[model samples]
Target chain A: MPISLPPPSEEAEAENTLAAIGEFGLIDRVTAGRVQPATTLLGPGDDAAVVAASDGRVVACTDVLVAGVHFRLDWSAPDQIGRKAAAANLADIAAMGAVPTALLVGLACPADTPVETLAGLADGLWAEAGSVGAGVVGGDVASSPTLVLSVTALGSLDGREAVTRAGARPGDVVALAGRVGWAAAGWAVLARGFRSPVAVVAAHRVPEPPYAAGPQAAKAGATAMIDVSDGLLADLGHVSRASGARIDVRSGALEIPARLRDIGRALGVDPLHWLLTGGEDHALAATFPGSPPEGWTEIGVVTDGEPAVLVDGRPYAGGPAGWDHFVR
Target chain B: MPISLPPPSEEAEAENTLAAIGEFGLIDRVTAGRVQPATTLLGPGDDAAVVAASDGRVVACTDVLVAGVHFRLDWSAPDQIGRKAAAANLADIAAMGAVPTALLVGLACPADTPVETLAGLADGLWAEAGSVGAGVVGGDVASSPTLVLSVTALGSLDGREAVTRAGARPGDVVALAGRVGWAAAGWAVLARGFRSPVAVVAAHRVPEPPYAAGPQAAKAGATAMIDVSDGLLADLGHVSRASGARIDVRSGALEIPARLRDIGRALGVDPLHWLLTGGEDHALAATFPGSPPEGWTEIGVVTDGEPAVLVDGRPYAGGPAGWDHFVR
Candidate 1:
């Protein structure tokens, strides 16, 4: 139901596609004059980029987005695609209670793709990463039928113990920091072929994850943490199983934002369902043994029981809340 | 002339395709029982994997391989594809004279793909990484029409100065370690419906880069270094331009390996051209101030001239020996 939007404009300075510009030439254009943070010792044009591992440890993860499946060119701009890619990977680092340091991109596009499309994508990537003080260090470009972006993010733990999903205790209090249901509501709006809900439509393009909340949660003695990429209930279940605890979320306690409620009301759908099952919000949900930090709203509690997530005191049974990448 | 062999036997213990298995289940199957290296502080699961960076600096790079473009499943096994993906990125680290520590894979494949194929790919990735004392620390799996592997390699400099391609000076001796032209020869053999060169065929599948020679060069006071992925002249040209010096390679002085010569004779192809322009060799080429240490053979001399590559006093005028990913 995504609304038909104009495709990302292909504004090529030269009348040449990726094939005409060639790989090295395209790379030269894509990476020219990009300022890097101090952590980037050696930048692009080298065999490998050298980044300062300030604390002698590196946290790493990777994610990929395939054209048509993860995104439709008709719906998203090149810059939005790039920004989403960076945000998706950086959110993983934040979920680990680490500060993101650098990103390496692996991009594939058809030979006929406009060079400006790649530049716009780079602009989006750099803009999002720069917002969090990270820089793109190295990447590879290849030709393919569809556009696929593979991004790997590196982060530093800053000498603190990494807050993992397996550390949640029975007595821990579950808390959430960041928006939920917004991206899902946005998706619904876009899916319905309506562009009136502009904010929600933009949210569907770029998720604004609360980056600082993760480290703050770690410092606040959070026992377990996870980023809500695959819906709140689904992701919370991960913490439940990993930590061998039962998580009971109070649906009434969730602070449903007024905008999300308004969007759901306009669409005649239940916003609560979106709050529980909406994916890609990238909100931080953690279990704190004591009172949670500021900016985090207490939403649930951990208890001794079978490892599962319960909504309002019972195991909520419905369609799966997480995204299955392989399920069409 | 790819001989269509039957698809890699689908030995999925659970006869389930990627969709049936689901993303989390597929990830578990793909990563189960893989032994990790000491460098992997945290492996898989949770948010991000933590890799030990002993020297306080990390070298990182990423590369993507698309099906039918970078590799063909009909011709090469999944394991071989995984190995090549790991090798390609690891070679970049080796080019920087860094010791590889870990790899993160971002894989996208069709839903109908057999689970065994992914397992085989994982086997190849783990085996290749293990050979270099590295580990597959993390990965993401998604769905796409064509198979794409986005591999990111992380390495530790081990407190040594990174040997960059831009450090070559006039009068430095150029040396090479590892096989050249073998993989290209294998490709040629396969292209012509002739696969008699068994070793060459295997070489084409798995590039055996001189993993040790890179570190040895760094210890031996080498000035500049690069991996021979894009052919000798093409890669050397990178060094030339970066260092602002001309590289003159003596064709007669090159010790053409016997197997390469034999394959060239059988195919009626010039081994020299393959040696000069053949891509995917993954060999280490370096510049040294005086005579290089053991295990490296001097192949050329750096001289004061415009940044370019010369073979026996002439600029190579043949077609590009290096790969251009966008070229059809």
Candidate 2:
């Protein structure tokens, strides 16, 4: 269980609001003493940042997260939210078989938001970026009634062909790296007002994406790859449609962790549903022509058929296999 | 004057809301017929976008615009808002002496928003980017109570060194490119509830930054440079502090536009004040070692003194030189 800290004192709160120090002051506070990697030719404190793209190509993607829609302050700390935002975009770069170089953030929040919260968010962003040898090179901030974080991650392809969804062949083996269903289980636990299973809850707060698996898969001659952000079946559906192939997941292949099984038993639900339909674990899912490299588990296969995702040669019974922003 | 558009019919509104079509549906509609520039190796529908960065370096920047804070739907159309957002970020890239290659957007809005409005915004972003041979490479959409647009622009320096704010030397000439104070005048007209002066209002809605001038200045051996987004003096203050030099603007060199003078006389506010303190015009300000290149007007000189920006060798009587987001 997460230890709930005491609320800040009145004096501390008064002195730490964004409005108290103004935009420039807040910028200085957040960016001060941060070290950037060599890839950042020029970091913040300028009109723009210059990042090295030695291979003559850059991979880029953007992700937006809102307060109530993506996370709640009561459920996760500001740092966790920031890490999640950065991870989501970085995974996209990795999915393209590129190494992350830098990130640019556009943050909007109410003026009265605590400076400490913004600082923590910045720290988390830096820490996560640093993990991949990338830098938070530049950003902009604005005042808004709702908190919104927009992160754009840039990566270097290093002269390799980008692994895309369209490359999956009919005779490819589907494989996955990194955890799945943990975050969804955590969500279920939190929704039921229970936080005792700290592992699941922590997974929900910050994902451990198999970032290295992306480029490794590419080097290992993987044909297609995608970071599973919207459940395994839903994301594979993308590959199926793009490559004009059919994908079928073998139910016997996916190993359900004991922790998740116990939670599912207690909740009177099947853990298989979570394994197949849950999202936000940011696992790397790929199609390889041969046996996948070590660290990747074979879970499915691609074949010449009507473009669709099937489970054991049939459709899954679980209702709605993924999260749709507008629908749910 | 901006033409008053008729409100959408109830049927049209109901049929076009974002929730009605869903996320993937909206993505297909907006990106279907659009053509991407040659710089985009892999466009939308992929996990990430691959953009050419042939110069071995990429310039990047992000800017966020909020519904009520940075823009008002009543004052500007969705297309105009999108154009402004794109232009703001692209201008930052230009200020770094780079040619824009691509853009990634992170848009958050209420689920009830009309798809027509969102399409218009995408069109505007595409139109503005296309003007400079750039493309909208990738983006994300999310649901939120407030509308937020976060745009990240990627650019190529073509092997030229970036003109940063920390390179101005004593005795360097300060030059400017593009209009100053026009957006502020337009903002003032809008604030006063008048819209007949279409030029100013349009300027306020969409800034016309001199994109080519940045590279021109860099090629001409500019020592330092910045974008005039936070008023001339206020931005100059940044350059002054960064370069550790005093900059003195010769007030006579700044020619206040006749239209602005007329509006100023009518509004009982001095045009000079607007020229000195206006923000968001996205003009280029640079310090050159010698006589500035063609299309740039020399308006000030950098000198050895305490780091500060002065007008006519003294601080202007204006209450404050620029905008502070939190302090209004």
Candidate 3:
């Protein structure tokens, strides 16, 4: 947990914190030597970057991260925070069955913030953007008391129809891509002072979203899809409301990873709670006509009933508290 | 100066408080009846929106506005703040010679922030986006101690080459497509307690960018282009640095509006300060091969020399300090 790079010496360096280096200098440093894809007609030096959208359509989403609210300096590094911010926005783009192409970021932090921290944040953003073959094109930098990051992701449809939450049909198969409840389990372990594996902690810090599964589901004729940011049951409720179809989850079919089970046991909590009520997993949940595409696990089915989510044909007894921003 | 709308009460209205309405409800209220142009394939109500990029490229940029730092709640209303935020990002898109198609916003405010305030912000955003024939596609909301807004704008190239700052050549005509220093003059008048007019205050709160001028400049064979968020000299300095050429401005050729001159006289400050050092006007500055398009005024010329901007063949001696975010 020590500083990864040597601490800056006041004399060795130019005593240039972010305040001293200033916004323009930091922008130049971050954008230097970065290769923009051919889809980008203009890059970061301009007022805005022009990127190719050959598919004749674009997918867009935005997310904001505030220090002490979405993240903490004591727990997460700047790189992890940046990656998390990008991942959240990218996941939303993926949910719309689009390929991410570009990102725009807005950052606000105190003047005293270390220059290295800002560099690390940029590195993290680029790293995450690289996962989907996208680049950070343009952004604004400003001064604030605490760190705040806001990212907007742009994506292309590649001539595919967008998969929306309202497209699910009755009798469709419900499936999921990527792991679920890992982040919540990881959060529990971190909150309860349990020494889980590094991978679990990393999951909590930066959820690895299923980047390719969305377009793959679209290609395979997915009826509807959404990313699981708010717990599984709560997110399903969105699908049910939008699609006007009842969703019934077969809990017995869930494949709870062994590590999550071990952590749940260690904390004397039920693994099912993590699976049902845990959030920020960034997993892709979709409904298909019959069988799902490869790498998807069957979890439930859509049926004709009131627009509600049920667990094994009964109303879920657990409270509907998932992730409400203003509600306690 | 008092609160314009009635304060929210428990029995006032269903959508009066964000906490009462919830995130999804607020989203529905904001997005209801919004009409997307043909450029958008998929609009709001999904995790992300899909916009058309018919020319195979998109232009993107982002900006952040924090209360007390960027704007004062006591001075500017929520509607003005929203319009300003959208204008700042959209202006960047226009500066890239692209037509804006869509926008994404991230909002963070105190839980006690009235839903009416949020509605006003949305109304302002929609009004500004409507001016450019675009739509607000996706966004995220969270709670914070103060109001913070982040906007990302997307634009289409429409089969034209993107105009970049590096393309200027010696002898190119430096032309301007919008008014300069108006925002700065307005800010001075407001700061000095000289109530000039509502239009002056409106200019300070929300800029009127020349949205059509960028694409028109590109069509007319513009070599390089930029949005003058910073002062003319400083913004042109960016073009000079990128193109590795000297730029000479003829101050006598500048078209200072009579309104600005009146405000300058009222505030007892040099109008040149507003013209040289003032920022946030969001005007279009570009270099043309020959004559600029209609409505563009010639202001300067590109020269062969070290990268620098000069006024009247000499370094400007006025104390025209350009904007720097880190410095107050």
Chain A TM-score of each candidate structure, as shown: 0.94, 0.96, 0.94
User: Roughly what TM-score does model 1 have, to 2 decimal places?
Assistant: 0.95
Clash counts for all predictions: 3, 0, 9
Query: Which parts of model 3 have CA positions greater than 4 angstroms off?
Result: A1-14, A193-195, B1-15
Q: Residues B6-50, candidate 1, lDDT per residue (tens digit)?
A: 764555433568877878888899788888888899899988999
By descending DockQ, how would the candidates be arranged?
2, 1, 3
Candidate 3 residue-wise lDDT, B1-328, digit = tens: 8769876666776446787777776788788988877777778777888877776777888888888877878778888888998998888888878889888898887776778888889999999999999988888888777678989898888888888888899999999987778788778767777656777777888899999999999999999999888788889999999999999999888866787778778778778778877777788999998989999999999999999999999998887557778744
Worst 10 residues of 2 chain B by lDDT: B319-328
How well does candidate 3 score on lDDT at residue B176? 92
lDDT accuracy of residue B229 in candidate 2:
91
Decide which is better by lDDT, 2 or 3. 2
Error of 3 at B322 (Å): 1.5
Best by DockQ: 2
Off by over 4 Å in 1: A1-14, B1-14
**What value does the lDDT take at residue A15 in candidate 3?**
45
lDDT of 2 at A174: 98
